[model samples]
Target chain A: MKNLLKHHETYVLLVIIIFSAIITVINPRFLTLENFFDVVKSYSFIGILAVGVTFVLISGGIDISFTAVATVAQYVMAVMIIRYGGNIFTAFLLAAAVGISLGLINATLIYFFNIPTIITTIATLNIYYGILIVISGGKWIYALPGWFRAFADIRLFTLCTDEGIKYGLSIITSIWILVVIIAWVILRYTKLGRGIYAMGGSMNAARRAGFNIFRTQMFVYSFTGLMAGLAGLVQALLVQTVAPNSIVGKELDVIAAVVLGGASLAGGVGTLFGTILGVTLIAIMSNGMTLMRVSSFWYNVFIGLIIILSVAFSAYQRRTKAKRAIAVEVE
Target chain B: MRSRHSELIILGCITTAIFALMWVFNPNQFLRIGNLQNMAFQLPELGLLSLAMMVTMLTGGINLSIIATANLSGIVTALILTAMINPDAPPPGSGGIIILAICAGLLTAMLIGLLNGILVAVIDVSPILATLGMMILVNGLTIVITKGYVISGLPNAVRFIGNGVVLGIPMGTIIFALCAGIMALILNLTVLGFNIYMVGSNPTASNFAGVNNTAVLIKTYIISGLYAGIAAMIMISRFNSAKAGYGESYLLVTILASVLGGTSAAGGFGKVSGLVMSLIILQIASSGFNLLGVSAFLTIAFWGFIIILVMVVNFISAKVLERKAA
Candidate 1:
């Protein structure tokens, strides 16, 4: 129990539980099974994107172009299916390829040029988004194929509500959970994951220790792109349409959630469990705001405040931990 | 030769070439005084925002909250004016209330800057995350107060600052030039400015040299906020309204301008003259594209492309210089 308490994820988990309890008390409807599933479903997209970003952040790099990559890849998938009459499998395959291709572009720039990841991604985001808009002529793809819509409806279970019915679990949620588990396992058990963490710890040291920086960066960014691509498809399917401009600005939410969940921007830190809890906390915050009849404008205000506070708290914790280590050394 | 002046020379050459091309292709539209005046009027808003970005970048920090600060300040000033004047009546002609409103807005921006500075300098939060949070917070507050509606109908005194011309030049352009001059003076002549460069180049060395790093950073951000306030005033007057969501696309462009102007994101480098030339180059390029009947969206892509090109050139030049030295 003490060991568990020592972990950063525990505190985040505690916050989520406390927030959920308070919101449930304020609005009894918040505790309903439907609401739980609703939060899970909504955060699934962010959750999937966060999985990839978690790795990047842990690897001591940043990727803001994920949302753009996702948008373009999703658009490509949808356009191929709608225009070229491709199958669902072919569409997804092409989407992943596009995602990987874009991610590799970001990776290559950062790796070869030694430019900052944030700056490179910022430029590429504009390039990718601009090309997408020009090619599509800024048109909204509202009507999607019947099969595409049906893909999201692959339900694991259903619940009968007093009003009518509710979905208990769907493939979307399953994918979200599965991705988290995969990220967890990779970070904990894989050599590449350790190399990423090592690179974040100290680039020079990692290089001296025979860790391949280029390969690690490529894996990190490409993996993020692949997941963003998948998340893009899921998001489009959920919305039942594709508007190229709509999905481009939501990278902040993912970054904020990841940061709130204890992912350090300085790298060499972060965990899948903490990321999940962070996503849950953000999802509930928004959900609770809606339940309390608060204006949506306040949502951004709260999110900003929370991000500042949580990071401050974590910094404080690290300071105290460092002090304790120094005292031990003195003894 | 990979001299220090080479980038500037390259930038100059590009600007001249583009101007020559435009003069040849669309001489009538591109070289007309009326069109030049329009370009001058439009340049300052982005130019001021870019200056705000450049100041913060000097401290090796970024203030993503610039547009949000501008919007919030404008909204605050608009609210004050709206409360004073009758909703249905015509705007008052007196400039007194307008001055006060501008003061109030500038004060709000200063406070926001102080908060941002403290968050980054004192609390030791990453500048990007700190300013990013501030950006969202300020934007949300503005939306909540204005309820997503545009605050139209400002007094005429305010509009004059945006629309008024002085000796064949725009008042807005003049204001932008004055701000640039002041920034250049501060950077070149002031002790605080010297410390800013020292601190940015090496904070540890600056600290060892007894430089007040925290104070310099705080002051730098405050100046950035002040620039944003003036830009907001210009923006509000030009549009005859203020809103929470205006100029949402200026964030990245400001960064692009600063970088293209030779402002190193790594700190300890940049110049006002370079920035002016870069902004002009961009304005002409964008307008040139528009004249050719290209889509406006392509301009953004062009900005991104140019930044990459500049980075590549800078990288290659640095390498060549190193090899020559070796």
Candidate 2:
């Protein structure tokens, strides 16, 4: 029972992969480069945010305002690059600054006022969306300079593979990969990462253990915000335009991917690799549905069902394990 | 007397300041009586939603899908009205079907809330996940049932309920106030409300103290669902239309009202009276901006900024509590 509880994420991953493989064999298009690339391109930015936000989730905090934060970052970048005549480097930095500041705002509220993360995030979420509207004045900014869009040109920049990034390896995809690797290293090797997990397991206990939880929380919120900023930048650059309302309902998809990827809403358990797999699983589903020409109407239904089933089963398996352990102890 | 006076002062200070600003700025030009009526008309769903938010939150959980349920309820009402009214067949504006359509919506919303409660309380899914799951499912169900279309042709009686006013007060505002009063009454005067607070404050401890945690949690869900239904009815009546997408944003606003009003998102503490004030505060803030006559786009940020300011106030108040506790 203990083993299963510990390794349920692994099992979920295995099952999903096998399912994907089976689907691939049945429909060769799923294996084709075009479909796979499409999946990568579509899911990369969301995948990046999921990987970052997983840190906050595992630390027993939720950041529901990330979509708003991302939108703000996108707007800042658009305004900087086009209206202000700023270089791409300056634009990206400005965007990142906006995100980090947002994260800091959230952290300060939860830590100082002892306000709940949910409430704080909800407020900030609106604030960011507000920024989006106020900045654009309810209009789309379409004429992004050429230099800004150049960021999307390198699919993989002639990486070790022949498939160019636009066909597969876009800058956003590469940067997301880099983030995953960096996060993995931090989680596996750094004391700060351990502090994150410890805080999630039990903040009181973590504090008793002498971990600086306030500091850790601040760092987590900030890190996630920075990543959200990066995501917004990529999204802005890719489309060569910014729409204030583009990501209105996308937060759910990102959260679903995080959960499906084997992270717990309860905190203290999840991996970058697991989240990546989770993002892929969702991306695959989205891709497959598109390939099948399913109505957008059904996409939400299927996705929603998948999210509920995955989480529900995980919860059920947990109770079953507790029952078995009690029986074992009795024996 | 001092505390009561202070709360009254705070409420008056906040609301009156907003009113002074709007009035000083000469709001009646673009903020016409019609727009004011429209705003009042919109408040029922938001008000009912805020009440539901207060109850669930009093139990220390959030139902992120209230809007979805409300949306679904709206769909059901539309469907029910259509089936009864027959837009093509007769002198199609018969009004008797109005009450029936709204009843169906409320019942459906209540059922959905019951399901939400069962999942969260019994199945042990966190309320966030459970309600979120319901949100996604309900949203899609709304689309599917409506076939991704707006279901209009509301019974004139129902449409009258949405459009009609009594003594210069829109039906939506009247309904909103009525629901708010009911929720406040139940929470303050009822045994069920007491149990909900006890259970939410500490589940294991509450159970040890003989409070039934599962029952309490389940009841909150029921209340939450009923509020959604009420909100759904108001929305259909006011718009004279029920789109699958119409009620999507109310969930956020109502929840904001609850949390901003001094209900701890952590549960175990809430005041519907405070929520009422908070709703008024939000309405005033939006109304003030509308009065200012700037781009309505700033409206969202304006709301967000107000919520953030409310939290700032909440945080300071918590510090005061901590000092007193010490």
Candidate 3:
């Protein structure tokens, strides 16, 4: 068991340590308070989404459509804040609605046809992206309303001398920090959360034990959708321009992060804390790589190599567990 | 048995409705030689990718690398043609120059396909994971070779193949039709095709019955790769220059065509002919929208609509079939 846990999240931690040591030696700007704040805010969007996806994945259900759902949220919000006189609050709600709707569509397809979760989500990914394309007519919407900018205002922990409070954390950063904490708490110390672990381990066993698979799947998918919606809003603030194509193929990174963070792509394993660490590690790699001006040429290759190795290691761990289980049964 | 055909009937109905929409809205523009030609050239990649998808789906695997493979081949062919064929001066016959380029591009893609097949079939990796790795690798390879630049300057012959038809018929249309025809024949008529279908639909049962599942899988990947190469040749010749993002937009559309055309993602039951038809239908829907001057960004939404409609139709058909069975 200890061996398994070590293998699960060990890669993410090693990456974090390796990058931290390298970046610190290479440049100290990586450890600065200001840069750290920016990283927190930027990663919160991905971090939160990863948390929800972790839950769904652990339950052995995959949701590839979240990126599409998030795209829908962004498109709607882009149109609303720009055209329909929608405020940040209203836009957020609408984004969430769009997310939940897409999620429901995925759940419906899976249940109605007994389709595999991966296939269902794959089909819906196109559906969501396709819908976005149709609605936007391949146009980009910029110039969101001013109130939408207020979402970025959450500031905390200023780094300033007695003379001037020049470097303080933003409200957005604080909110992201708070949300990550809350997510960790709800996932680790809650009964329903434990149910997720139970369910992901074995669907048939969970069902035979009278677990409500539909409700769990519906909730998990909707929750992931909501996270995607929230991520969309954060994305809007971070980039300050609504890019329809900005995050099209980002789910791969998210899945990579979750898997890197010690969450199993095979399900029934993962933790909130590990996910945050994984997200932070990726952030550092991307941010530091950019800061160092690593050859734009080798950057993707480097990152892709790490991601492949990390996931391959995760699969190896799962296989060991499977073999062990079989051995136990034989015994 | 009737329930099984529910997806087919719905797909047929939707296809007919699209045909009607084109005829009703702007029959002149919709039913034009030029438009038909546009679709014929435009759909080969989608058709080829769908076949690739069918292989993976049959084996309970999915390859997300189809576009990457296609794009990689396109760029490589373009690069070779421009650099090798006419490095110093303009050649009198560009057609011959391009033919050599096409051969190189298709061969390279097939080589990549061979890699994908080995990774999935021999390594025992999940099809999704195996192809995902290949996708990143190919995309990287493309970026590495091209440095993310568009390649122009193909032999005239190649360009002619893309733009010209066999005496009033565009070569693109003929090539695409020939591909579909060949695929349909091989899939329905040959034992190799039967083995592929068998492996994809029920690996365990097929294994017990002595089917060589790994060999079947490897063949499918190679075939898909070869198709990607062929599709790239068509695309490059048509454009006269290999664009930077040629095959990126094709994966989803191809997968959609396969599903919407009534190939079960579950595997054993799919028809290449149906997939080919569905590719044409997709082309028509998008082209029809483009003609209407609708914001093409909503192409995603349109596809979403198609998928949902396909699903709902499939759902209703299944229900009706069940009722009839009852």
Candidate 4:
């Protein structure tokens, strides 16, 4: 019981429960099982992206270019499928390849130039988006093959609400869950994952420990790229249109969710469970606001506030803990 | 100091090279006075923004909220100006109201900067995340206020500041020069400037040496905010309107310009002259491209490529210098 109380995930879960209770009190419809699935389905893309970023963050690097990579990959996938008539497997393969290549480019730049990850990613983000826009002429791709559209309707289970509306666990949500499970297993049981944690904890120490820095970095960034690419496909499937610019600005939302999930920006600490809870909290907040009929603009305002406050709270806690440790040493 | 001088010379060479290339491409149109004046008018807003981003970079921090603060400030001034001055029946003492509105805008930016400073320096949050949050918050507030619509119809005097010419120099250029001069003085001559470099280079050492790192950081961000406010004034005046999303693309460009100026991404090394030179180089290239009818999107890609290329060059040069010294 004491151990559970000390966990960041516990607090996140508590907040989720209390916040959901408040929202349900304000709007009774928010408590419906249908709304639960709706929120999960709507935010599955973000959850996937957050999971990918969690790996990068825990590896002591940041990648703001993932959204750009996702867009470029999905754009290529859409173009390929639309023009050549490929199956879903082909589409996924194309996206992952594009994503991995772009992610490798980011890794190569960081490794060779020794530039900071944030700076390198920012530059690449623009480069990728600019090239995409220039080549595509900012055109939105529509009329995806019927097979691709049908893939979105593939749900494992289905239920009917009182109003005869069908709500079920979606393939997208299942993909998110599968990604989380894979990430959890990797972080907990894999040597590569241990190397990532070591690198984030201290690069010099990790290097001294015989951890291959380049390989870990390559894996971390490319994993993010892969997830981003998949998320991009998921987005198109859900929306049924491929807009070139739809996914760029949501980088902050994903980063915020990951951070709120107890991932230190400085690196070396985070959990998949914590990240999922963070995503759920943010999704719930936005969904609750929509139900409450608040202005959509206020959604970003609240997110910004939550990011500052939560990070500040953690920093304060760390500072006091350090002070207390010093006091004990003096005694 | 020697390295700084060399960096400036390199930047100067690059600027001249681009200018010559543009001239060669379009000798007839590139050298026209009208074209030069147009470039001058367009340079200051971006120039001011680059400076805003530069100062924060010098402190080992970044103000991602700089553009958002600028837009919100411009919106605040726009709201005041539109409310106070009736375009149909202009008031006699409207200039005072315009000044007041401008002040209000600057104050709004300062307040946002203060919040960002508190979050970063006082609360110990990372600079990138803190300013990013502030950026989103400010942007949201601006959206809420303007409801995603453009505000326009400013009085003539306010427009004069952005468009007026004096002694053959554009008003915006003159304002940019004055601001740059002030910025140069602040970074080079002031105690605060010394402390800023010290804190950025080594925060623990500076703290041990009795520097108030928190106060210095707060002051640094406040100055950054002031520059953003000044840029906002010029932006709104030149466009003759204010909106929630003006200059969204400028954010990346500012970072690019700062990096191209030889500002160390890790902080503690930069120069105003270097930054000014890089800004001119960018303006020349962008204007030349416009004359060449190149797509604007390609130019953006080129800017990204240039940032990465410059970093690589800097790294190689530093390595060569180290080897030579050995």
The best candidate by DockQ is 4
Question: Residue-wise lDDT of candidate 1 within A1-331, one digit each (tens)?
Answer: 9898778888888888888888888899999888888889877988999998899999998898999999999999988888878667887798789999999999988888777787888888888998899889989998788888888788898887997876688778887888788878888898888998999877888888999888988999999999899898878867888999988878877888888888888999888888888888899999999998888989888888877777766777777777788553211
Q: Ranking under DockQ, best-scoring first?
A: 4, 1, 2, 3
Worst window of 10 by summed lDDT in candidate 2 chain B: B1-10
Q: What are the clash counts of all predictions, listed in order? A: 0, 9, 34, 0
Off by over 4 Å in 2: A1-5, A18-22, A83-88, A157-168, A323-331, B1-9, B27-39, B87-97, B321-326
* Per-model C-alpha RMSD: 2.5, 3.7, 3.6, 2.2
Quote the true-contact fraction of every model.
0.50, 0.64, 0.29, 0.66
Q: How many backbone clashes does candidate 4 have?
A: 0
- DockQ for each candidate? 0.63, 0.60, 0.34, 0.70
Q: Model 2: per-residue lDDT, tens digit, A140-205? A: 888888777676676664333344533556676777778788888887798889999999888888
lDDT of 3 by residue, A20-107 (tens): 8888778887877777777777787787678767877787777777777787888887787677786667887888888887787787
Per-residue lDDT of B1-326 in model 3, one digit per residue for the tens? 55546556666777889989977888679889888777776666567667767656656567777777888889978887878676446667765666777788888888877877886676565666667656766776677777778888766666777788787777877877788788777787887788878887778789899988888888888888888787778777777777545667567667667776777766787777667667767777888888877656555557656766666667776677679879
2 versus 4: better DockQ goes to: 4
For every model in order, the TM-score on chain A comes to: 0.95, 0.90, 0.89, 0.96
Write the residue-wise lDDT of candidate 4 on A1-331 in tens digits: 9888667788889888998898888899999989988889889889888988999999989989989998999899999998999899999899989988999899999887798888799889989998999899999988899999999898889999888999999998898888888988999899999999999998888999999998998899888888888888878878989999999977877887898889887889888888998999899989999988888978878877877777787778778778777543211
Stretches of candidate 3 off by over 4 Å are: A1-6, A31-34, A75-94, A113-153, A160-168, A262-266, A320-331, B1-9, B87-100, B298-300, B323-326
Best by TM-score: 4
- C-alpha positional error of residue B179 in candidate 4 after TM-score superposition, expressed in Å: 0.7
Sorting all predicted structures by TM-score, with the top scorer first, yields: 4, 1, 2, 3
Per-candidate TM vs. native?
0.96, 0.91, 0.88, 0.97
